[model samples]
Target: MSEFFQQPPRAGNRFHTDPSLRLLTQWHLPDAIYEQAEPQLERMGALADEVMGALAEQAETNEPEHTPYDAWGRRIDRVRIDDSWRELMRIGQREGLVAIPHERAYGAHSRVVQAGLVHLYDPASAVADCPLVMTDGAVTLLQEHDPGLAEHYNPRLTAREGAWTAGQWMTEKEGGSDVSGTSTVASQDADGRWRLYGTKWFTSAVTADMALALARAETSAGEDQGLSLFLLELRNADDTWNGLEIRRLKDKLGTRALPTAEIDLVGAAAVPVGSLGGGVRKLAGLLNVARFWAAIGGPAGVGQLLALARDYAGKREAFGSLLRDNPIHRRWLARISADYEAMLALNFETAAQLGQSENGGPKELARLLAPLNKLACARQAAQTGSELLESFGGAGYVEDTGIPRLFRNLHVHCIWEGTTSVLAHDVVRALGAPENAEAFADDICRRLKNLTTAGTARVKQKIESELDVLMPLVNDPREEEARRIGWGMARIYQGVLLAEFAEWKKSAFDDDAGFATAELFCRRGLVDEPFPETDADTAGRMAFGS
Candidate 1:
């Protein structure tokens, strides 16, 4: 026989295979909502598997190209992407990945269903979700600030055929996260039209048809009355470039498939979207939506890693036995699996709260949970991806193995929308509101009320005790202290969420994995029973000398 190596088979239909995700949707969503979303979920699941399995190799190899000018030196600033990328976008729009929530076709359950679909679709889309995040944010902002703009742009943004995406341009060279330092100036033209003249330091999806930006309106006030939000169309009605010049595409550590650029705006015609001085207030809607999207990406990436690692375990063998049969290997796999489950529980619960807020439920809890969930899930994804790579041995580190991308893609979630420190401060600010803090505490208690097992109850008590200590510090927490508290709060929240799901699964699906997962997560994450450190020789032999 010829010498050969065995490899794991490609993933099958993701929706059908993932029992936890299916149970999560059933447990969190209302019956009517689940029924309405079922068909769409199935379609997205199949598409996701196809994208990650058959088309993933080519898609990963394809990097977006920036064409700055036409052959005749006309300023085009075109970005060329692969056909596979375009097809993925078309599939996403046709599935109403971004539109369903905005349109509210399913009433109060729209956001929940939309979030679930995005969770399934994000991992295989090769960062196409980046533009979708901004597009969804723009839709939400426009719908509230200027209904006229929403009416004109919503169709284009949501359409599967002839779709047009939107971008967000906010960061300037001087102001990385501080919009108060915005120096972009807007002035009135001879025709009494608003025009923007400034440079945007970091603009993602630069080839987008339009962008929502922040520029200070030139006023005589001395107090620097905050930046105003404006909508700038990238092209004129005649298909010519507007008064915008793309400086160059950004060289990023990851997300290379998505084109990001720096651009200078000169006489670029714009229209004010919201109140002149209420720019920060108006941006709340976009920030909320984008943060939720950011939170979901982590779980989705971890799901991909778990799938790859699990498949490889059953196929690869050593010492005349399969890796899946080894207790040590199984322990590592179990830890990652439990972590992923706990993260999904937290993320979906937050999604449920967000959906409920749209129907007159408490909005404050959603506010607090969005940043917390994003920060925690992003951290989990990075750590889990690293371990999963190690679990696959040396093959995981290779590009062709398709494992490295998960790790690279996951790191972006830590920095995108907001960093851990930025979000930690936001959490502190949210908790400052008395009503918000009360609502959060009430929700956590409600989830824990049904814990029947003594072990689960003990875990719940520990989490509550931690919350008691953390809530008092919210009012006067220093930056570093606030970050530390934020991490603790996230662990408590995830533990509580996992316990709730465990109880539900025990009753409904007769599944014990959920309970086991919850127990493991609480013991490790909340109780702080971290794995012990080993000697250098042992670590070296395990990590490399094998």
Candidate 2:
């Protein structure tokens, strides 16, 4: 057999060959998955590399005021946010602005997309622009803030062509993540304007051009319903700031480049997204895509973190030996590498699954996996960042190394979207459906049976044990303990997936081994875990606050 055809297959590995860093070199996506997505990813790589390079340069300078900008001549341009905020807002109306420090939206989009991808289905109306809009939200915001740009509001272009930036209207003075407790009153004006009359705590208060605002609508019964979605455009008659006011910009520990603002709406001009009471549901469509983006971005950040660390280890000598030559450093690098691979495979699988989502309705499994991926990717990124940063000693603590910024940027992943606790609750919900969980688990079991690695077998046993604790709870419909038990079950599921992916990394070249490991992971994580709560009620509360 020829060299290419004779490639060996293992149980837990997912690659046609040993999955390596080079896997990204070729965007090998099935036509059904992303006919254009692979190309898009390729385009994004250049952008990512440029962004990383700019960050590296800025880090070397160690100047806080100097913003990171891609030195890449043209493809990736640099735009100053604070310097040119006025002009960029104008251009954003028509072309749409890209908003980075895209912490919340990124997490939301990534989680949703991850869920859809695992089921090989689409969660929204299968809208093509949804993904593009979510991905470009941060980028567009940067463009708008830069002085070189001009702002013009174009309703027609926005509705059709789609842009990368998005506005988040999630926080209320009463509660940030808890929408059920929201009291934002929405009344229809004589002129048919849906007026929102309430204070928003974190409205992207200043910079956001487009928003998915949540407010209560009056029903025929003279009572208010849960919430509704309003798409608000914040531009004016002479091309100036409309009614949306930026109360203040928050000074935060990380993502300093991305500004956070508290906003208030004084009879702000707005448009409805879908239906009045459908704000939660309508926003779900956008949020899903946002969550998926967040999940994937975490891994991307982790990759950048590891790359910088690896370079440092190879060159930095300590205690009369190269860092790589040191046993402790080697062990640390190995652990980080392994976690990184597990994260990548998990993120990629969900991405591939999302690319395959169609009209029939996304697989139910996707719903369950969204939280799992979000939890896994975010936690992994945070863990990897801390571990990798520690390996650098004092250099990791400073900005010049290019590792500290990554560490800072990744810290917020767990805070936004659906927090870790929220995700744990979701896993419990998935366990509620034993048949569904079992089917998901069974599929993984079938995959596990075909593996060759001892790691695969070990991981498989671990997953089975988790399912044993989870299955009964999932089957129970008891109301009082449902929420708590479900949360625990999700945690178990996540552990299984982590273990399974560990096996996949060890045997990426062996199809049988990889497949089995993937199965074991899915059975434990995706099939068994319940969906998490994304509503404001869960998000606004601190676990120990009460």
Candidate 3:
């Protein structure tokens, strides 16, 4: 008897192969920008398959090495990363992954184009997207604050040749979100130059050429509001760490290929970006950009798993036939596709808002949308990423198959920008403003009307009911229920956006995907809360394992 063996799945050009991505462009982007973006997206997709995909695998195997000393035991404190990792940065640089929006080549469509490229590049990036996110954030802040810093850093950050990445240093033992208690104190030297002295509890992308950090100025007497943003290079002319000590690299669960470290600033030479006071406010631009990146990352991560799962279904066999032919597997794949497609719509919607904001559109919408996008997409990705992993059966559990990384890396999205709960609170706070709440509700209602006009009345009604219930909760939300409030808003946002696009798809392309996705999002995306019947006593016991 012959032994049965499963064949490995194959993936083609990520951008070119995915209909939803193309569909989104057609739905959201201008024809002129779409025409220009399509070819570049094609190139990125090919590179994603032909080049970056292999690099992602290699980076996984050749994890970043943190060498604390040299060959002769010189205390260099070097974080040596894979050449493949280096190439990934170069690929992003050459491809204008972060530069697209700043370049303004496509005008207001720039962010949409950029989102498309990054969405395609992410799966193959092995979390190299981490540095790119920080770098993009750095670019946004520098451009808005200091002219000289922007000139010096923006070119290097956006370089097509020898590009550079930047780190985000904010966390410390004192707090993660609470910057008021940060112990990293900034003091000026005799020359009036700034320097930072304290420990950075969790500094990501430490191997980057530069970083934007938060430190409380020594001269400030106030509490949280006294924090300042400082720009610092990673190395000196002699290739030594610039007043920075890499205490140790973190042993993280995922993103092992991306170097994350705990650093002690030994008088790290720095330059203040803007006014010494309100550093957190100045850094908010960077945070917004980073949050957007995190939001897109959700779709990127899950989309990767979906591709692999769909491919695997065609190749792997079950009791009697290929998994692709199995009704259960096909149904699961359909739901995955629906969820993935719906989230993709939300990503581009947020991206479009960002693009418009650059060209003088409503900035407040983007602010509210950022938190909504991050919270919604992160939860969806986390939930579905794990399910998609199970679609591979035991093969997903194995490290070698490269499927687990999709899910493993997703955990950070929920925590990185802000935990789902943190974002929920932000949403609640943002919605506290009557104008913001009104604008948010108006946007959803408008989008839902499009689907309603397209004859998806049940879909619109379901979402309308959700909004009716959800609106009151966010308007006057409890601390514990903040997550539910945020998620409810995000889900409604996704559903309406999906419905709008499905309307376009139905009329323009006559495709069922948009209708299917819209219906699924309304049905599965919106919910009344988890186990409302279960008492707090039962829920507490279930959670505590008591």
Per-prediction TM-score to the true structure, in the order listed: 0.92, 0.68, 0.94
- What does candidate 2's lDDT look like per residue over 397-501, in tens digits? 876545676677676667666687666665666666665576556645665565556655666666567666655665664554454454444444444444544
Point out where model 1 deviates above 4 Å.
51-56, 219-225, 475-478, 525-546
Residue 47's lDDT in candidate 1: 83
Q: Which wins on lDDT, candidate 2 or candidate 3?
A: 3
Per-residue lDDT of model 3, residues 75-194, tens digit only: 889777889988887888889888888889999889889999988888889888888888888898898988888988899898778788899898889888777778888987777788
TM-score leader: 3
Q: Which candidate number maximizes lDDT?
A: 3
The CA lDDT of each predicted structure is 0.80, 0.50, 0.83
- Candidate 1's clash total is 0
* Every candidate's CA RMSD: 5.6, 11.8, 2.5
- For candidate 3, give the lDDT of residue 308: 76
RMSD value for candidate 2: 11.8
